[model samples]
Target: MPERGARDLSPGTQARFDRFSPTGPKTSLLTVPGAVGAEVAGFTPVGDVMGCVVHQVGYTETSTWSADRIGQLADILRAGYQTALDRLVEEATAIGAHGVLGIDFTITSPDGLVQEFVALGTAVRATAGPRPRRPFTTGLPGQDVAKLMLAGWVPVRVAVGISGRAFTDRWGRPMVNEWVGNIEVPMATELATAVRTAARAEFTREIGDCGADGGIVSDLKFDLWPVHDVAVAAMATVIGTAITRFREGPVAPTSTLKILPLTRI
Candidate 1:
């Protein structure tokens, strides 16, 4: 077995041995605060859990588009995210954890050739009994999960939708030269709509694969920047925590209405 500790992949005999060990990193079973830490209703935290993946970005043409994939940036992003998510689940399961709460995801490029993605959270167990078919993953805090549980919802997994897109200008189109008069540049509008639709569909498909009803989608994030002065490329990201209905249970007093409304609409 490997000794669990801070894994820096450092240069030393002990580090080398720990890397090969079957066990996960040994983190102090202490309390975590903020979004990554929570005080839920029905679950207890065991320890801090983490899963890290360093992937070498596969080859992609910088110029032309490939109908199979590179043409669709969302596909490439999905592949990377899926692999990282799988690793995170594996670590939690290894420690016999029921689920992970308030999972925080981070990504960074090490050298422009490889990218590193990390998912970290607190591993917890149900206070009642064993977990469902498998441990669940959620981006929500522990308190939220507890409230959700009371409302008959269980988080299935953390889900995301991402898109990388660019559009080419069709010079001949009269709309392109809106300066001539007053006209709408339908090209940008159409391309933007198409790209966003595609990304959303891909995200829904992923959540479905987790064998759940649906997920709670947070605000969609967008990073739209210009690619030169001619074309535009945008990255749209949506982060959410997938959830499904558990048996109906009692809600907390806070879950109920506090004050009665004076009038009804």
Candidate 2:
């Protein structure tokens, strides 16, 4: 009888690879200082803290399945995690945060299919001196910044719009219909300027109306449509939190602040 070919151990071996593993050394954990309950216990006033969120490019089910077939699903998932982490880090850097605490991650799917990957964290300046090792707990009625940390969440909305037209410029190149052959300035410039101005105003107005301190502008989309005429339409959005500061009571010594696991409490 012909010798049987070597059995395929790849599938069996590959199954083990699907398990999730920590991307890097767990030495980089961060947490917000102060007792979450203190804000509500009349111990300390709630201060405004900058927040930011970031998402990774979504992968289709097909891509994910294919990665599994190639025994690369772990790498793909890790890549997604890193992408989100990097985005949060970039935002923290922009805010001049010494360290980010209460970091969280979340995975969302609108139709039961993985639709988005998100990362979020509070950007805060750490108190000077050696950091405390554990979180203290106290009684409060306000949101617990530590417990409310979400890993995968989309940011609040800010609106943006862009518009443009195509015609031939003074240079004889095809451009917006109304413009002469390739004019010195592109016709789209006018529409762009108008839309940009409107977008900024709208963002400011929205934030003010919502009682938010500030918002992060992102995913500003610009689209050029050739409908009826070569008119362009652009859209953009901002994501952030509407924060309200409140003073509870006098700050206390030996305030017990509890750092709960990152999740909705």
Candidate 3:
């Protein structure tokens, strides 16, 4: 077995675990309704946890890049995001959390080559039932988690996938117009479609890696722009939570109402 503190946690984070206590005061990032929802689902909030990583990306320019080169850039960025999530899981383990809920990611790019990735969530413990060997994670809110559990599905992990593609004009090809007539940019459209397809494939692979049945996509973002005078580049990212069924077949609905209001009027 690997040593407990041998993970890549920072010095401060490691030290925090050194003085950890199970009975200490706890904290949570959930809203009041979220807290109640979690309680109803038989999960008790342990604490609010966070992980962060700042990395310097290697790719210098998108202008001269091919699809493969853009993919390499995405690989580097994916590493940063994975590292941040790993650290977050480590923190959750320190607090004996069975899982983390309502996870959110914050990414800031100071420049073209530097980025900081942060993951934040509320750690929780199952009030009853067998605990997992490693903590599970999800981007869904506590209320959504409760709903999922009631439906016999359980959150497995946060799934993320990113893909990038670059399209460039060949030699002697006519340059695409800059805000000219209403013309379809075939190259750009193809690049965008390719990136999105690859990103979703990657997202599905993430779910496979978790041994989950499927995933719930919460966010899909695409960034497309012109690079240099002859190239168009696109980057796509998909974020969601992988989930597995705990009980086979359809589950009975928890409420009969079609719409449940959050507040009493």
Candidate 4:
């Protein structure tokens, strides 16, 4: 049993726990300009950790009218990204880290059929006490983590959402009550609605898996293009770190009084 404090750890989680954790009790001397040391806020940097995965992209046929043609691509992406995330967690856990901060994710298409995903971050542990059985991952920098801790909240993990979209463009006719000769372009209202719906649905599902009650979001991105000239594809990817609120917002900093220098009498 590691002395770590990941509460609510299930039997499955414990089974996978390392039988032992080596004790170094070392401090990270690495410094960032304008950033406070981890020790000042009761944390110790374990090391810089990373994880990566490469997945082959399946070929998809194009269709001008059907959007479901590329739904399977979404599933493939989901699996690939999730694998990368899992590997990242394993690395952080191996270091006996309580959480990861300043996480960076990278995506590259090594070839037409193969894509790679990489996760990188600095791992750290709380010095004041044991951390949760499972450490959290975040894109937040070390300074932000320290500041948030003072406010009574801890980052959980990085959440990701991805959705595959396809659309067709064909202004078949005008779609407005023209004042005699109205020439308003028809709105792709359904396409717009579908885009939001699918992307958000994918994002919501990804965050749900992290068990985060509430958190911040960022890096929501999209890649849209037409392949084979018959169908348009929209690939939306959103990234952010999830957080768990502490019992209360950060405690108010204790006040200190410094008597002004006495006037020379």
Q: What lDDT does each candidate get?
A: 0.65, 0.37, 0.84, 0.65
TM-scores vs. true structure, each candidate: 0.71, 0.28, 0.86, 0.70
Among all windows of 10 consecutive residues in model 3, the one with the lowest summed lDDT is 1-10
Q: Write the per-residue lDDT of candidate 2 for residues 133-174, one digit (tens) a residue.
A: 221111111244322222111122222222222232335443
lDDT tens per residue, model 4, 1-265: 2344554433433443433345534333235821364555576677666677788776554433245545666776777767777776776676578877777777788566787888777667787765687878888777777777777777877877777766554543323334648452223344445665677776677667767667677677766555444445666767787776766874575985567556833
Shift of residue 72 alpha carbon in model 4, Å: 3.1
Clashing pairs in 1: 4-26, 5-26
Q: By summed lDDT, which 10 consecutive residues of candidate 1 come out lowest?
A: 9-18
In angstroms, give how far residue 22 of model 1 lies from its true place: 16
**Which rank order by TM-score, best down to worst?**
3, 1, 4, 2
Q: Give per-residue CA lDDT, model 1, range 44-161, as digits (tens).
A: 6655666666676666555444232234545556666677666666666655568888777777896877777777777666778546656788877766776787688788888887
Model 2 scores a C-alpha lDDT of 0.37
Off by over 4 Å in 4: 1-37, 62-69, 169-193, 227-230, 250-265
